[model samples]
Target: MTETVVANPFEQAQAGRPTGPLVQGFEVIIGFETHAQLSTESKIFSRASTAFGAEPNTQACAVDLALPGTLPVMNKGAVERAIKLGLALGSHIAPRSVFARKNYFYPDLPKGYQISQFEIPVVQGGTVSFFVGDELKSVRLVRAHLEEDAGKSLHENFIGQSGIDLNRAGTPLLEIVTEPDMRSTAEAVAYAKELHKIVTWIGICDGNMQEGSFRCDANVSVRRPGEPLGTRREIKNLNSFRFMQQAIDYEIRWQIGEIEDGRKIQQATVLFDPDTGETRAMRTKEDAADYRYFPDPDLPPLAIAQEWIDRVKAGMPELPRAMAERYVRDHGLSEYDAAQLTQSVALARYFDEAVSKGATPKLASNWITGEIARRLNAQEIGIEAAPVKASQLGQLIARISDGTIPNSAARVVFDALWSGEGSEVDAIIAAKDLKPMNDTGALEKIIDGVLATNQKNIDEYRAGKDKAFNALVGQVMKASQGKANPAQVNALLKAKLG
Candidate 1:
């Protein structure tokens, strides 16, 4: 079969525009099609359970197996999830949408044709915005449609024969498609993460890459600057974010190398071999016409009312973008900090609770994104599983803000709290004698001693050397055994130098 290449309107608009950074003198173009398994209990078109890890062929009922007398029925839960996604992404939810039969033949597809949305999808026209390392980027989405998943073709266990597991048959999925808008692998991965966050935050999908619940297919191509889009090769089923990045980067380089060697990129689907860090062609990609898509007679067109959409919208939690904006507006956080805090629902909740418990916004942000995040990453746990409670962290931060403890002392208190050696922030501070030396006369004596011993540093400070001033402050802190208030030390040192 001949390869079919589809033109991207986004790329067409980029004609003659200033192109972004190039890979081997060719601009990289990428788009994504992600399949997020709807978090429903039953299959999209059948009553069979959609739970994972079930035995092979056991979950397939008459409707899932396409029995002669059985007819497919739409799952209400799946349709509601579609609405939730549309609302979450600011997409237009079609009042009426149709399901079509995507005709294909595979051993695992007992029905021989997969039911999906084609001509009229349920969601259309949305934008996913995320920061690719400080610079904000937005990717335009074409559509997100409801569909059913096919069974898995197991090839590992049997020798010379493949097994089919129908446990995933007729499972609900939302295939979210995007325009060819990303210019780099970084942007592509960021867009995928943002999309994953939205689907999971809205309770539509679990966003589990390991269980085949969330998967991405990246369409990658490279073309010279200001040229028409290149013929694309799709890398399919990138289950891990790390693998997704590796796969896309490798594909871009390979495409560029092929062009330099006078080879034309073939439109095809490829799989990423994580072990070798290479992508190999699986099949020549097909166009829409190749599938012969036609409305499924077994399932009727889905009709959604405005009332239903409004109901779903009302029940939806505050989205990440909105929460981030609130952080910027109400809490006075930078856009970057706001975005980082809202990476997950649990993390955002932790920040909010900490703030509510009297933690200063910027200080709380610094602590959580800095020390707390480092520890969480080291332990491979979410913020919800943190050893320090939100209230405890808030109280600790309050102590730092109130001049009762220096920032250095706060770390010691934090360590004590995290290790379960102490629970109350105040108790920990008292046990460690972490409270700063608050006595004005005693602090003055310590500062005088530091200034007398560090005469060279004091002389340099008077000669306008800022590092010398910092050295004097450090000397004071050292003499006070790290119990001196840093602000007080800085003020005293500057006065003595003058």
Candidate 2:
């Protein structure tokens, strides 16, 4: 199960290849199967609460327990949620879809089979497009089927014995499957993030990776360009983006090494050991036929009406892609910047609110993506949890726009605002006395004093040394106690020198 492998020269982190495409030697083929746990109050087929936490089997009911007398009844709300996802993803909602028994036996599966859609899924054929660096990549979806989740097999405690918790059993899930379109681990992660944004944006799923609300299974293989497709191994249950990339990178290197050393890669399921940064084979992979799928006799064919699709469509908010396009077309923001703003609903709202409050689109975009994002990542928080409000940020940007404070002074004010020192941007600037000296006469006096003191720099500048000019600018800023506008200082100094 364990093999010692060297580092991959073509790996993403170490590859040194430019962002657009991989180096010419290898081609990576990747696909994803993501399970987005639907946001429903009850289990898909039973009245048991779908609430995440409870004492082990307390949430399991007769139907979830697969008791002999119990019959499965589909939850209307779950189907509606599925239809909503289909509409959001631009997928087709089938008029009639059949549920099948995906036969499998595990300690946690009380029914020894899972109710899922096989041949005819509820949602079919959609595309998720996202940016990997500056490159725009699109991952095409094969089908998204509705299925009930299996229970967890708890392996901790109890002297070499395992336990089964059926609380998660019958929880509704949308299994989103994609074609093998991704050619790199980076692209795969980008596609995954874009999909996550879409699901959470539409309010169908919370998309919490830590709580197991969303998870991905990545199928990866490597081949020479224009060669036949290589065998793929499925890496299962990658909950975090960090781990997802690590697992795939390791698997690709392992497969490539195996092929190079005259060994054939095997088709199997693998588990990633985050601690060791390696993948271990778990079990042989299963194809659809191995599941022995058959129509579930207990559940009837699920049908959707055109009216329901229209209803869901009418209630749908602006999708991420469309919103990004609008931002680009109307606001003159770059595609990358627009996409970053639209990563989540809250972040997008923050940007929009700032712009509506009179902040320029590009300025708001820059601050949110650069300064704000840097701080948020450092604190390990999200836009919804930011201490500073969007309106406050908008006000600060306004001050910068009107030349009330220079950009340097604005940074100081931002720090104060972020740390709760002051609520208003102007008050912070006033209290700190960080306003730029806007009076041309006052700034000219300071520039003259600096020139009189720094005769050496003036002489160097007259000799055509550009560095000396920058040094004189630095002196002017220092003389003004860092309050002088840099652009204004530059203009006045150049005029005086010439």
Residue lDDT tens for model 2, 1-498: 221122211122313222224433667888899999999999999999999779999999998989898988899888888898888777778888889999999989999999998888888877888998876877768788899999999988867899999999999999998877787889999999999999999998999999999999998888776566678899999999999999999998888888888998889999999999999999998877799999999888887889988888899999999999999999999999999999999999999999888789999999999999999999999999888899998999998998888888888889998899999887898899998887889999988999899999999999999999999999889889889989989989999999
lDDT of model number 1: 0.89
For candidate 1, the per-residue lDDT at 410 reads: 92
Screening candidate 1 with a backbone cut-off below 3 angstroms (N, C-alpha, C), the clashing residue pairs are: none
In order of appearance, the predictions have TM-scores of: 0.96, 0.93
lDDT of 1 by residue, 195-256 (tens): 99998988899999999899999998889987788988999999999999999999998998
- Give the whole-model CA lDDT for all candidates, comma-separated: 0.89, 0.88
Poorest 10 consecutive residues by lDDT, candidate 2: 1-10
